[model samples]
Target: MPRIACLHTFDSNAAVFEEALRATGLAGVSLQHTVRADLLAAAEREGRLTSDIAEETVAVLRGLSAQADAVLLTCSTLGPAAEAAAPDSPVPVLRVDAALAAEAVKAGGRVVVLCAVETTVEPTRHLFEAAARATGAAVSVEVVPQAWAAFKAGDPERYRELVARAAGAAKAAGATRVALAQASMAGAAALLPETERPLTSPTVGLAAAVAASRG
Candidate 1:
């Protein structure tokens, strides 16, 4: 079985990936998880991803690459670090949101990218805009108000509900595609009706990582 090293900024994300793996029918792949909440905490404290934080994230990604067939970075805030580390890594280092952004841009129209946290807004916007550049897809990002608070308060039910509402509203407002910008927000996709369901990262990112592992 291929070994996938998953680097997550939140401990809660590990379970999100586990569930996503099963949903993607890649449960047979071996997953090695490393959770480093402090990495995101430092970024949140600084109000941005500092140079030192990026370096430390790269170091972690490089280290994980050595032990697994592929490395997947599951935090959107730290996603740029994965791109920085990928060229030097022996194995493919995949950024979860990158895959999500790519898929969102493929529809070639108005894409509304939803993020729960303030810290993720800019990074998520940049990721999707970069992905949209080539395809001429118009990308816009919106932060789901108060959704992150519910997530931090350990009320996943409320978090998903809020996120789902934001997505549904965006779709009703004329968004051609709605993309959930974080792996943690994946559950919100299930909460929305099928017609309004948003595209999410975890499952798509895991499948891309597994395919990369094979090569």
Candidate 2:
């Protein structure tokens, strides 16, 4: 079995990947998780990803790379660092939102990226915009602070409810495709209707990571 090491910014995200792995039915794939909540806390405090923070994330990935077939960074805010470290790592370092962005842009229309955390908004917007550049898809990012607050307050049901509402509003406003920018927000996608369900990082990202590991 190919082993994919997952780097997460939240302890809850470990379960997100676990559920995603099971849902994908990638039974042959194995996962190793490393959660460093401080990385995200630091970024949130700084209001942006700092050079030092990126370096710290890279150091973690470098260590994980030695033991796993691939490393997957499951935080959208730290995605750029994963892209930066990919070239130097022994194994592929995949950003969780990258595959989701690609898939959203593939729809070739107005795509809205919904982020619960403020720090994730810009990185996710840029990611989807870059993915849409060649495809002519329009990309927009919206940050749902209330949902983030709910999540931080340990009210997960309220958090998912808020996220789902925001997604529905985006769709009603003419978003042809919607992408939830964080792995933690993946549960909200389930609350949406099957036809309007938004693209989320965990399922797509894990599948992409596993594929990269095999290759």
Candidate 3:
């Protein structure tokens, strides 16, 4: 069996990422979950990247990489840390946002990349822009910081409510599609009306990583 490591921080649970992996139905692949509350708290407090946090996170990934065929980091705030961990890993390290970014680029002009946290917003924008540039797609990315605060506050209903509002704002801003920046936002996206705008989630990216790692 192939093993994949999923690294997460406090805003999301490992199960959400694992559920996406299970939905893929790929044989001989299992996921290992790693969580670091301190790292999450630090990122939330600083609202930006720090070398210390990055180093701690990379240490976690290094431990996981020893046992897994591939790794995926679910926290958008720690994306730089995840990337820094990648080059040194014995296995491939997949950024959870990568697939969603690619999907957003493919969705074409004026793509709205919605995120729940302030720290996540800019990093996600950078990811989307990179993806859009690579794909030759003209796009616009917006960060919805309030959504994450609501979700972290433990009100699922409120999270849904905020996501709808964010989606509406994105549409008004000329976004043809919406991409959820975190795996935890999948449920919130489902609550929104399905119309001309398409919704992209991180689940598909995790699934793809699981499959690629298995092969």
Model 2 stretches astray by more than 4 angstroms: none
Cand. 3 TM to true fold: 0.88
Number of residue pairs clashing in candidate 1, backbone atoms closer than 3 angstroms, sequence gap of 3 or more or interchain: 0
Among residues 3 or more apart in sequence or in different chains, the pairs in candidate 1 whose N, CA or C atoms overlap within 3 Å are: none
Backbone clashes (count) for model 2: 0
**What lDDT score is found at residue 95 in candidate 2?**
98
Worst 10 residues of 3 by lDDT: 193-202
- By lDDT, the candidates rank as 1, 2, 3
Better of 1 and 3 by lDDT: 1
By TM-score, rank the candidates, best first.
2, 1, 3
RMSD over all Cα atoms, model 1? 0.9
lDDT of 3 by residue, 1-215 (tens): 77878888853567676667666676677777888778878988998767888898889988888888888887877887777888888888877888778877785667777777777766777787888886676655556656666777788788867876787777777776777777677766566567733465556767767766766
Give me the displacement of residue 152 in model 2, in angstroms: 0.6
Please, what are the lDDT tens digits per residue for candidate 1 over residues 122-212? 8888888988999999999999999989998999999999999999999999999999999999999998789889999999999999999
lDDT leader: 1
lDDT value, residue 54 of candidate 1: 93
Model 3 residue runs over 4 Å out of place are: 196-198
